[model samples]
Target: MDVSKEAKESLLVLDKQDGNKVKAVSGIDDAGKLKTVPPRKEHEQDFLKIDKHSNILENFFSNFMRQVKDPTHFEFFKIKTDDVEKVAPVIETMATQKDTASQEMLNEYRVEPSDYHKEQQGYKPIDESRIDWDNLKQFGITREGLEKSNSLEPMLNYQKSPGLHRISATFDNVKVDTDARLAFRETEDGRIALAVHGVRKQPELDRPYFGNNFSAEDKHNLLTTGNLGRVLDMKLPNQEKPIPVFLSVDKLTNELVSVRADKIRIPNEIKGVTLDENQKAELRSGKAVLLDGMTAKSGKEFSAEVQVNADKRGIEFKFPENQRQTQRQENGSEFKIPQKLGGVELSDKQQNSLKDGGTIYIEGLTDRKGQQYNAYVKVNDKEQKLDFYRWNPDKAKEITPDNKSKTQVEVNSNGKTNEATKEQKEPLKQGQTQADEPQQQQNKPRGMKM
Candidate 1:
């Protein structure tokens, strides 16, 4: 009895259960055994081997799950696999068609060698024995000398040392006599000595010590000797004393004299006391005098009998010549006439004319004291009175003699006098001119006569 088919069918069920236990227990069985048990053949062992089957079920299940979860993944895997199979045929055809294609591509991509490496490949090593020691020595590079010196020897050698103080002297282009022959000396310990050569006056010099860098000329100048006498002994100059002078009283006012030594004396006549120089001579000749006690004379007191004629229309004050004194008085006198003493009279026509902006004229008027009086006219109406002088015929005629219309009286907006003339009207045209016709008639034919 053959159990191969049965065994193949039973494997799926066993794998679904304990697959590790089935793997561990599976093996070949003897031929004489019950025919129900199948023998494991060589091909069967290859198919059922656990090593070959390792992770194969896991991969297949993962692929199946991926296909079920993402349809695009399934399609992409299928298309990529098909494209790979198509690409293998294309690569094979290209390989068989050209042998140089691969060689040409490799040659085009290969990096070329560098110039420095190429030159280095042909270079020879330098010879050490041919170097000149003499030239190296000039540069202070000797082997023993360089070894003995410190590493910072050059820096130490070029370092600057401390300096000593020195005195610099300059002289103007004059020479001094040195017959006296002064000598001076100084030491580093601050010691000094001074002497004079060939001086029989005193062989031993008694001068003070001035250390090194001291000159005999400097010592002589500091000692104040010989030609430096006047420069050192000079004194400042003195200021002058102010003088006193005499001045006249008249000159004091002229500003020509400032200081006075004596009391100012004025003469009894005081001739120069005139207001100006041109009157000075006249004053001196006694033609003019300063009248200290002058007084104005008192006016005379005279009385005149005034006659006043007053009525309802007007009033007048008069002094009759017969009543006035004919003889002149010893003292001057004055008489006054009041404006209210005279009253004005207006006729009905005159009043109406004044109210209608008319002007009045008076002639041959006389005043009291038998004197001829100037004539003046005034309007009394309120509106007419304001500009009465402006509309006066005499005043208007004086201003505009050529303008006769201004002299002709006219009524104003205030019922007062006005100088403006009435505007003249323009005359009508002779025939039916455009302006003469009514507006509606203007549209009709001009051929029709008026």
Candidate 2:
């Protein structure tokens, strides 16, 4: 018996809440990947005639969806049995087509939309004779610029532009900055369809972003190098269970997005450039790296600067030639200064001291050897990341010590105290060598806050 030919894909359903439409589901506990699928009982076959009517069925599902009128997110919702019930009849028709010879298909996308929904949300026809070009003018993207980039045709069509675009549109009215993909998806209904893929902010450790939760270790590794370092089982929006995924920071948007562990297909040769292990690791970490000597589909060799964008949820090619002008524009803008390092949040005094670009000795970091160690850490503004060193650099000033931990390690392990710090009544921390201010000034006397 040939197991490969006999194996079948378990039934996959469109889940409004399953992993937010980025991926699909199989059995009850099947997280993004299909492991074990309990075979459907014999009676269930009558419920679905899967191998037929793909196009017309697409029209039915779209009409059914609008008639129900569920004002919900079509993206990023976890699929549940109840959620699957809404579209199962039409979707079941696609099953035999879905169950392929291989088990590698994981992220199942939407069925091809019907012309009704594609035109105007299943109820109206679109008028494409006139475009409100004022929308593009505010963003500094002229028709000439858009036409030059070959984005106008797709925008005129129902789908969005193929790649994520950098736009300076006024989102907050005060700020015209967001990484979004443009579409004419809802034009017939008088709506602007933009999939906002990225946002501006440092990944905050104190809270959750979207539905993805981060552990102390995940936070530390992400903030330092922008990579989660390992695969994490994270529960997404509307998902009842967690799925295994690798979390990466979008270097351009600073937005957090994850790639399904099984779906992470790193091509052996990207364009014509073959990447080794080190290059792959760098890309996985969400760093913008440059790869040279690649062949484009146009049969031309070119070099590209690339990084993982939250919009694509995969590796995206960035043109290398424009990097210098982009860097110059970005150089004057300071990157957000992170508040925590290795899972420890900085104190006001500690943070204030770093205002002038100083180093602070932080402990509790585990090295690759699994041993706890301490090091001087500071923001490397030039590289736009954290810099760690065993010894302090000459140009960096020292951050003030926290008063709470001051007395914890004042005395040496052998019970001898440092004469300079012994004279101070406030005591000294293990990492601190001197006292610079009075302790009373550090507090505002807030009630029950600590």
Candidate 3:
């Protein structure tokens, strides 16, 4: 009749029956005391073991499912199972459920399909025709390519699971310049011993200026002043051989020399002969001279002499009397003139001078006779004989047209005028007598009697 007491007693019996294997289930008893109902011995043992190994078994199953899901894994396994008959239906059902579950999860999370699979599916397949097959054959990718395909499953596995990926690093193509010297050596135990004298970037010259017993001043001048004249005799310690020493201008010049006893010592050669101040000054002052001259028809000739200075700046010309003529011509020719000189006109000279460097000097012109005139000159790249002084406005007007005219109109205040033509005055009418009409009487009909 008291079920709670009965249940408690039963639980106590079960607890005593199972040795450490039974899991105890607790509850409140009839007396309001905490009581546990222990499981059966066999069932307690099985449940306890399951609880202990649940995580391990779950992980193993997950890993196995992941392997089975990969397409590349199926290809690699090459299993002869009847996939269409046995596995297809299960896969279809699983895929449909997975898709529905994925959609539900995505809706709950508000995630996009693109975000889920972008990294795995976005890459485009390489077009084989577009790739340079000859280059691939030359480079060694064909056999290696097949090997990569075979390892696709492992590769995909590594990519999908962050925990399984492995990485490797390597370095190659080590080199050093000719002027540099390695300053450290590796020991057998993989430790490195650094040299007391570090690497230096410089050429080593064997010269007679650096001797073991030379004065410090001589060594300083040899290195700093680049003076190859100084020579010093050095005696080796272990032998009677005398070695000519040369000064070094390198970073590691303070270090000890590592020279062998049998090596031959040679003199340091000088680069080249250098010029002294006097010779250099002479070369600076020597240059070709360019002179310009102008001649007129009066047998008068004028020239400008430009003397180049020693600094190579410019040639300074003494302002000559002939320069005045050039200045006058430049000023006078500011506007085009219609006159002709020699046989050429001012228009021709204006065209020539404007094309050239602004000043045109006429040469070898002493006389101007009628229309025959000649003066030599250069304009731009062309040379011509021009008549410089003949500019006649009347001749220009004849060749072109004299269409330009001036008209005058006079206005007078009074009737009197001087130098007035007939056409300029107002005309008067011909005379007519006043008696031609009959007179009218006052008593008569004034409208009809006249």
Best of the candidates, TM-score: 2
* Pairs of colliding residues, candidate 2: 17-77, 17-78, 17-79, 18-77, 18-78, 18-79, 19-78, 20-76, 20-77, 169-176
> How much does candidate 3 score in TM-score?
0.14
Which pairs in model 1 have colliding backbones? 186-212, 315-343
Give TM-scores for every candidate, taking all chains together and pairing residue i with residue i. 0.11, 0.29, 0.14
Off by over 4 Å in 2: 1-142, 148-192, 196-201, 210-212, 232-234, 243-246, 259-263, 268-312, 315-450
* Model 1 alpha-carbon drift over 4 Å, by segment: 1-344, 364-450
Q: lDDT of all the models against the reference? A: 0.25, 0.48, 0.28
Cα error, candidate 3, residue 298 (Å)? 56
Candidate 1 lDDT at 410 equals: 19
Which is superior by TM-score, 2 or 3?
A: 2
- Give the local distance difference test score of model 1: 0.25
**Which of the two candidates, 1 or 2, achieves a greater TM-score against the reference?**
2
Looking at candidate 2, what is the lDDT of residue 136? 58
Which residue runs of candidate 3 sit more than 4 Å off their true CA positions? 1-195, 198-211, 223-231, 252-450
| Candidate 3 residue lDDT tens string, 1-450 | 322221211111112222322223233344533233334433322221211111322332233333323322110000012121232233323323447774443232121222112223333333333334344343222424333334223222221110111111122533221111112233587443322233333323433323344355645543543322232345666757665433223222222232221221111110111223343333223222233443322223434433322111222222355464353343222223224433444567566554343434332222211211222332211111222222222233222111110001111111122332222323211111111122212222336342
Kindly state the number of residue pairs that clash in model 2.
10
lDDT of 2 at 406: 31
